[model samples]
Target: MESPKRTRNGADVTNAAMLVDHHCHLDFPQFAEDLDGIIGRAKAAGVGTMVTISTRIRQFDRIRVIAETYKDVYCSVGTHPHNADEELDIPVEDIIRLAQHPKCVAIGEAGLDYYYQHSSAQGQAEGFRRHIRAARETGLPLEIHARDADEDTATILADEHAQGAFPAVLHCFTGGRDLAMRAVDLGLYVSFSGVVSFKKSEALRALAAELPLDRILVETDAPYLAPVPYRGKTNEPAYVVHTAAAVAEARGITLTELAAATTENFFRLYTKAQPPEELDPSLLKGAPPQ
Candidate 1:
């Protein structure tokens, strides 16, 4: 009984559904040469917004500048687990202060990364807790990065939630079903990246299909993990469409439905990032015409 959804230009909802690449590092040097083109391509590909996540608190100004340079770009504040030791001294108060910037929308890409152990486990744990406190204080979502440390990550998340609930998403999730469900149980979201589109990622795709639509999100984690067809090439926000398509196929839904659900999820978690005024709000509110 619902009317077909259309964009301002009257394009079919199938082609006009907007997407938000909620996580990526626009400040990375890989994007230095073609930054303008990158943003242009992303917009052209229907990526309505992007969040250039911060991996180090010290470099937040540079990350913030990227978000400021483009109207559709936003940024997050916090240290990545790999650099946790280096920024171990950074207090929760400092993170809270940095997050006060209007352009700052989330509190972290922080959590556990036992894969590389670039930072000591203790330091990573300490830093993770700090970012959580900042997220709780600022009422902003935390972008968690958990790699090969799912158990610890879930334990920290559960322990932290017991202290106080904070909005968060497990970004670039390549974890087991248990971790995925644990995050969902905590009222957090799980974001899929290009990794989900790989040939050997059947388990990941299955997990993506299993997650509740409202608690799922999609991101590029760009200049890294480029999706299939462009697997060996540098990833960008534009390629998030491929990732979304993979997720949609996994979930037995259309790309428009996936885009609407994930975009809504992004806005729900990153409450500070405003959608573009020109976007048709109706597209986000209901199922598009079948």
Candidate 2:
């Protein structure tokens, strides 16, 4: 059996301590250099593990290379709805086969994005259906990204859930409370990103506070949406610290308490991420080094 990791405050992972970045695109070109330093800083921030989400199934090999390169890193396997047209033929079998790799932890970063409409709404929806099916077939968590299409997203998820049960997560979740409650009802996890830290995101913060601890997760979604203080600068995995702090305050808890809770939530949802290498006592004591 795997040993549990100790958080920086000196708590075990099972007791609502330790933080995990459930969604991030670390494979983006923005981190081509100094990725090592990014990982190091993220670890120091109490973000012991991260998922470098895959936006294109065709490029999943490269993403897998990322997971293979680091102990704490893992990846997903699917195409973004924005790029649905590009990898339209990504077979479910191909995705399932590729996901067999131990490093591939989830099935997406995929879903609808009406806000951009980079791909036709139809193509996006079609791609979303395919990824959801993949999630059901592989028993891997679905990393859903919805923007300006809550109704459509919910409709699809509801339809798919009836087919069979599967683990799914709403990544970078900024939806209204209704969606949060619906996802929770559907046995899904909601992961907030740096956007949760924005001054204009009081509604989202309120939703975070309202959410049950077991269903809440936090992510950086890095190379974008860097939390405040680090806002306006290039976002990196390391900045997840600020995101966690914002989430902690939103939920009326200390950073260590928030970190521990979110971390436990991620592993509970993913069930594949191994524990962090060494337990940090400072994090458990809520006095992690600044």
Candidate 3:
């Protein structure tokens, strides 16, 4: 379980196998100028598939366009807790309606975010419930973002799940062990982000390591939280390799094994983003030969 060496450019110099970012924000203005090049870089870095997450239902069109433009890209649709108030009128039916798109594979980057209280807690909770109902109705996975609101987040998920079961993943998980284990108890997946690679994140890494490998996934949450040695830089799908490596080492497994397990868990949860029986061999040819 030694750390995988990274080239200065962030490629896993030791591995050529593919990984999936599963979560990203390619539509953000940060990538507007070089989105294509960025996608190419991610491809070259062995990111075989990516889901550009939607943060606002009003911006679903923008998120969808990015997914539609990239063959390997898919997306989710829903409001972030910060903007939850803006789309409160939006009903479960509308969310399910929007999710019907072939490229929309999941729902809600939505959940409670007490840390940023940009929207009212009430608004966030209401929006979160609507998104949960939509996920349950649509049979699509729910992408959650719980920060400093773990108890409420867990309570809502459990309360709703009791009404009916729905697939979900605690995207970019930074919750307590109680919340994480509860999510696992409810048949949800827990995804780790670049934060797990931080030197101060030993506790997080240990918690991530202890989770069931089959119930765990990995992501970038780009363009944010770039893992070290790219710390202080804009994060992207290509940097997911760093987080993946950290997770693999924490789990006492090789990077290649973690890649296979996380990618499988991703598809099993997202369900709609089916990997081809055979990936294009050309995708294995990463980053334009550097």
Candidate 4:
């Protein structure tokens, strides 16, 4: 029922070619003044679906409001590593309870971020473990944010995964190939962000090229890393197309094929998110054909 959209090159991308910005922060103030315009731009670029990641569990209502307001916008629930201390007392039950909402499709933007130890390593580890437990219990994918803590992140993911299987993804992945491979070996997915589009990211691009196509996804991680050309500007979900284009080139595939694979991979992992058929018909318009 949805028509196709056009890429920057004017290629007609059907409903099936719709891209998903699997991770972003629409709740952040960077786009507060133009949130509607931002979402519209993303849709225009064929990023028909997006997930606004939660950074603090206590502020989930703000995140929830955004998701509830936008038909195609879904969210994950759990504190990010930087704010893990604030939510250290929140139990896994609460995370799982809040995630019961139809719009809450994943467990976290949680994991270790030694790059900026806003929270103690111990606290982050504890919070990360709790989130893993929540993911295991709820059957939602854990959206991990590991930075400069690959070994610890991998260890915890493997340790918990061994105890009981859970779906997970290493989001905005800029880690070494070893960590990427480790995540894949454990059946977790790796999502690239605008960073991969940087001209100096050849090493990162190499890792991306080495990944199994099905194991890859892309994001804007907006209000953060904007892809090339828009690299220094305020990032938005709309710019995810550039990141996807860069990745598609790295993988030696067309944007349409990469879009289909990543979108399918998104739905497969975030099972709580509705399939395109169940999405608002309006959002599906201009999407590539199935």
Candidate 5:
């Protein structure tokens, strides 16, 4: 955990063994009053950097503020599949345009979500396509959020990548082995979250172990998906160490090695990230109403 400290704007860390949460959502109200404390714990826990991903393009300006204010945090642009209908008119050009912001480093937390189907399938698919185009046009990595729609997710990704390749990471992966290979085949990275730390996730841990080291990333997907010790409780970025520990165990490496490798993977993909400012107390939005 003790490494060279760096900002989010692509500064080299003195400690190559530092860990990074390639994806997190500190903007959610769940962390409200404690956002500063949450981030403090994360930094103290050795999480050197984090990407505070976005779910609604309309809320992106606020997302930018979080990234700009925090020295170790960056943000993304795009609508989540659940919010697809709310932002149906958001075009690929708009996404690409907004992504030009210095702190907007990735294209999405967008993809199919058949499990919930919160938005119509067509809307989700359309949004996914728009984000794919944005990712390609901006040359920013895509952060995908597929869940229980493996076939459609696989199909769309294959179709779009056929036209032109784009960097992408399958965030919070929870599908079968076939989908994993398909994602890998298209040269997209796979990010493991707390789900990989679950008791029945031996299958997922096996997948994590088998994947090429270069193509893997670790994430908290925080405010949700807390790993083993904290499962079913509210999660924040600091607990990324537990999930990182799970990933390291799956890969048969020490937490130190996992920290080093994933930190490298994060910077490689989030190339636009440099050192950020000091951590922002207002990173999350309003606290959720109880």
Candidate 6:
């Protein structure tokens, strides 16, 4: 594997045809000690781009700084379902204004999480709708986080989308086939994470095989669900390759093919994010996987 080169300021400089970890939390304290090294290892593993997601609107500055520091990194802005109550007072205009940062490309990791229900269902729905409007207004993709609340998530998406179509993706999708198909039917993308690579995720893998190729995406949700080989360890962008490999195998395709397709899918949804100038075009042109 080729290691990433970096500048004195620690921005990744190496480029290759690689996969993208569409959702992660680089700003999390778990990466505080070795952030640069994590970026380097991800490059070595052929992950050329990463989007560190935001869990709280108030903490967006920390996430923004990480994106600004790493040339290949980008970020999103919004409150997670867990933090929805705390940021409920945050107006839609604030979310729009914050998303104007050059490195900020997506609108959220926002949606319903009945599984945890840290925030009231009403609070989560309100925040989700606000973020959806931000996405509709900003023309940036919304990174939705839904868990055990598929019905409500789908209902809100349908209701809000009926008002106006917006670019969005269901991040870390673990919902049933019905929700996945409904999301795709609504013209939204569905992203798979390390959870899809688990032994008990046979049903999830089957769904991955069934979803339309253009709407499928892969992520690590890292510093969280690490894939098989790194199952119990802290995940970083590097591990996205394993998730990609898993998705590719499940789809009966090569890693290079999966990399090309998902990376293309990523840029298509994240239109605000620009590819690194140093990126090797051949990677997207189907250069053999590392």
Top TM-score prediction, candidate number: 1
At residue 273, give the lDDT of candidate 6. Answer: 76
TM-score of candidate 3 relative to the true fold: 0.92
In the range 15-120, model 1's lDDT, one tens digit per residue, is 8478999899999999999899999888878889999999999999999999899998999999999999999888789999999999999998899999999999
Q: How well is each residue in 146-262 modelled by candidate 5, as lDDT tens digits?
A: 999999999999999999999899998888888888999999889898888899999999999999877888888998998777789887777677777777778887666676666
CA deviation > 4 Å runs, candidate 4: 1-16, 277-290
- Over the full model, what C-alpha lDDT does candidate 3 score relative to the true structure? 0.86
Candidate 4 lDDT over 1-290, as tens digits, reads: 12224433454444436789989999999889888888888887777789999999999999999999998999999999999999998989999999999999998989999998999999999999999999999999999999999899889988998899898999999888889999999899999999998989999989888899889999989999988767788888877877887788888888877877888788778777765554444432333333
lDDT rank, highest first? 1, 6, 3, 4, 5, 2
TM-score-better candidate, 2 vs 4: 4
**Candidate 6 lDDT tens digits, 228-274:** 76789888888787777778778987666777888878877888777
Error of model 4, residue 184, in angstroms: 0.5
* Model 2 clash number: 13
- Ranking of all candidate structures by their TM-score, best first: 1, 3, 6, 4, 2, 5
The sequence of per-residue lDDT tens digits that candidate 3 reaches over residues 197-264 is 89899989999899998899899999999897888888888888888888988888878878877777
TM-score against truth, every candidate: 0.93, 0.89, 0.92, 0.91, 0.88, 0.92
Lowest lDDT 10-residue stretch of candidate 6: 7-16
Candidate 6 backbone collisions, by pair: 17-283
State each candidate's clash count: 0, 13, 2, 6, 16, 1
The digit string of per-residue lDDT tens for model 2 on 1-290 reads: 11223322343333344567778887888888877877777776556788999998888888899899999999999998889888877777888898899988899878999998999999898899888888888888999999898999989888888988778989899877887889899999888888888889999989988888778888878888887766787787766766777777878787777877776666666766666767554433322232
Candidate 6 lDDT score at position 119: 99
Tell me the lDDT of model 1 at 105.
92
RMSD (Å) of each candidate, 1 decimal: 5.9, 6.7, 5.5, 4.6, 8.6, 6.0
Error of 1 at 141 (Å): 0.5
**TM-score preference between candidates 3 and 4, better one:** 3
Instruction: Return whichever of 2 and 6 wins on lDDT.
Output: 6
